[model samples]
Target: MVDRQYTAWRLYTVLRVRSQDWGGSIVVHQGMDNDGMALAVAANLCGAVFLGLEPDPAQARVVMRAGFCDFLVNTLDEALRAMKNEVRKHRPLTVILEGDAAAHRAEMKERGVYPQLQVIREGEEPIPTGRVEELSAMLATADAAHSLLAMVVTANSNAELRGADRAIAEIIPEGDPRRAWATGAPKFFVREQPPRRYVWLDDPELEAMLAVLPAGLTIEPLSHSAY
Candidate 1:
C-alpha cells in the first residue's frame, strides 16, 4: 500500500510520475517480488498484474491500483507465470515497503523469494506511477488527511460526547473501531489503503491540517466504514 503517512499534497507530488513514461510500475499483493514484477512490466512495457491469497475483487483492485499503473490481471496461476516471465530479466528485485533495509533483506531471504534482494536507495528511482494509479493514491492520500482533520473536529465540537463511549458501548461494541476514538472516531471507510499502514497523525499535525481548511467547511462523517 502507498504509505498512509503521506499528506495529500505530498502524495500528489509522488503520483506525478506516470508508468507510461517509465514503462511500468508494480502493485504487489503480499511481497516485494511483486514489485520486481512491476520492474519487469516496466522494463518490458507489459501491463501490471496482481495476485493474492484473497478472492475479493474489490480488495484485489485496491491492492493492484496502489502501483498507479494500468494492469493485466488473472488467476494466481496466470499471475505466477506472468511474474516469472516479467521478473526474470529484472533479478534482485527492488523492494518498496518501508522498513529497516537489513530486516527486509533478511526476511526476503528467509522466504526465498529473491536471493538477490537489493533495497532501493533514496536516489535509485522514485517508484513509478500512472494516471489510473493516481486515483487510488490520491484517494488514500486525501482520506489520510481527512482522518487527521476529522479527529480534531470531533474532539472540539463533540466535547460532550467525550468519554461517553461507555454509554454507547453496547451500540458500538467492544473492539469496534469507533471505541478507539474517545471523540466519536471518524468513521473512515478504508477501502484501498492497507489497514493501519497509512498515516495516523499526531494532535499537532492534525491541528495544522485543520487550520488550513476554510472556516466552517464541514467534513461529514460516513454512516459506516468503507469496505
Candidate 2:
C-alpha cells in the first residue's frame, strides 16, 4: 500500500491538495491528458473507484474503452447521484468532473459526500483523419497536428474491443506515455491523427491503414527490432 502510494505520487505531479471533511484528499491535475489517465489507473490500482463525468459521446466511448474510469457520468447531477453507490462499495473513491469545479464541488459537499475530486475542462478533440495531401498541408500552418498510431487488437475481432478482448498490440512511437495501460489481445488498432511521419516496420494491417499517407512523410522499414 505504501509502495503503491509512492508510485502514484511519483507518476503524477499533484497540482493542488485540500483537506476533505469526509476523511479523503482531493488531487488536482491541469488537464485530462496522460497525467489524468495515470491518476485514474493509479487510483484503481490502489483500491479506489475512479469516476469521470464526460458529456461528449465520442470522447466518452474512447475513455470507457481505455478503462480510464470505472464509472462515467454524463452530467454533474448524475455523478452526484452515483456517489452513494460508490460509498456502498466500501472503497476509496476518485471523481473527475468536467467544467466548473467550484459549483460541482459545492453541490457534492451539500449532499454530504466527499471524495477525491479531479476538476478539469473539456479535453482537446482528436484531429480528424484526412487525405494524405490535405493533412500534409496542415504541417505548414501555425497549428500543426500529429497522430499517435495505436494498434488495439481484440481476442475476437468480430466483437467490439471491450473487457478482456482489447489490447494495444503496438504503438508507432513505441515510447508514448499512453502505453502505460497496454494490455489484452491482438485484434485491430486505432490511430489518433495527424502524424508527421508514418513509419512501417512490416505490419501489413498498419501499412494498409496508412496507404494514403503523404509522400516524404513515410519512412522505410528499418532492420532490427526497437521493441
Model 1 ranges off by over 4 Å: 1-53, 63-74, 91-227
lDDT of 1 by residue, 1-227 (tens): 43222232233223223222221233332333333323322222222332222234454455345542234343333344555654544421222233333443344335544312121423332122221232334434434333332322222233322222223333334543333332222122122222221223446544543455334333232332223
Question: RMSD to the native, candidate 1?
Answer: 16.0
lDDT by residue (tens digit), candidate 2, 1-227: 12221223223212111111222232333234444555554444333455544334565556567645555554567665655565556454555556544445455557654444443434522111111111112112211112323222222222333322222224324443222233211111222232211121236545653453333333343222111
- TM-score per prediction, in order, is 0.22, 0.36
Candidate lDDT (C-alpha), each: 0.32, 0.36
